[model samples]
Target: MNAEPPPPAPQWAVPPEGGWTADDLDTLPTLPPHTELIDGSPVFACPQTVFHSRAVSFFSGHLLSSAPPGLEPVARFTIDIDRSNRPEPDVVVVRANAVESLRQTRFPASNVLLAIEVVSNDSVTRDRETKPVKYARAKIPHYWRVENHDGRAVVYVFELEPATGAYTSTGIFHDRMKVSVPFPVDLDLSAIAPRPRAADPQ
Candidate 1:
């Protein structure tokens, strides 16, 4: 049997008086389609490449497994950066102590320890060049950018420099990745890279 379609997303537009806020988002009966709030305006997220989706799932699964007792990994969850901007990161690692009380649909930047973005063709610049700057400004301690390189998954790790509110390049990793920042972790990059599709025959 065919599955029922999802309910329609709420009409997303700028308010006539002020702008969209986190509180306004909470009042939403149904969320909009891949919408992001930037500077009080709605910016719809681009359609993702299949590889992008795979990497998000792959990293989320591994990050969860390797997460420490008090840290939890959340995927595709919205975070309120301030009164104006709310972004949905591909994955974020947060403290359980704070998250235990989080009933709201979106948490603030203060709750996030690490943010990860899987780059797609449409979102390449946003994920790599743009978000790192924003995440750093919000004081997210760590940031990661995952992309496909020669059919292998590569990760670029960043650490926040609080003094300047900028990220310092920690490492660029491909294949086996070992690190200790938020916590110690050993990751196999190939696990996230999508396999080539099988060929059709006549």
Candidate 2:
């Protein structure tokens, strides 16, 4: 059997600074096509597509609205798992009190109660594979995948089992399914379904 091509090197192995350092990442040019440091290597994320943008906005809004008094909903924010990796998840749920502190510096992974990723055409694999492994490895408690395609929405919830470094599938909630997280609330998936727009009449 052909040797499985060596697993792609961790994104952090290459140094944009000639030497990996936080100062190098901070000082790098900040311009269009924002780059995030993952495992010390720079990963460029493209601008969100209309569908991707809408899904993120809708889900984030709902999470925020439903969150209990002590839980905070944050959107498109970076979470720094370590010096080598800082990923910006689509939506994150954290403790209400840690919001200000997380905003002031690199976002803390410890305080993140859940991390959500909305699938974009370009990033489906990275979001589904790379990020899941990374999040599981970091021992983050919950990870959610929101897929928007084929005129439908599908949400998958994975609860992490750190001992195995794997995320056990908890539940898959589709349209109309009520899904519960560890928190006190449950989400109605239909509330976030994508509605097709009417075609202009000829």
Best by lDDT: 1
What tens-digit string does per-residue lDDT give for candidate 1 at 4-112?
9997655554363578875666665455666777667766667777778888988899889999898889888888888878888989998876575557566678989
The residue-level lDDT of candidate 1 at 99 comes to 75
Taking all chains together, the TM-score of candidate 1 against the true structure is 0.83
The local distance difference test score of model 2 is: 0.75
Q: Among these predicted structures, which one has the highest TM-score?
A: 1
In model 2, the runs with Cα more than 4 Å from the true position are 1-14, 17-25, 101-105, 191-202
Q: Write the per-residue lDDT of candidate 2 for residues 1-202, one digit (tens) a residue.
A: 7777777654445555644543345555542344566666677778777667777887788888888889888887777777777787889898877767533644678888899998888788878899888888777899989887575678888998867878998878776545567564555665565566799999
Tell me the spans in candidate 1 whose CA falls farther than 4 Å from its real position.
1-11, 28-31, 101-103, 196-202
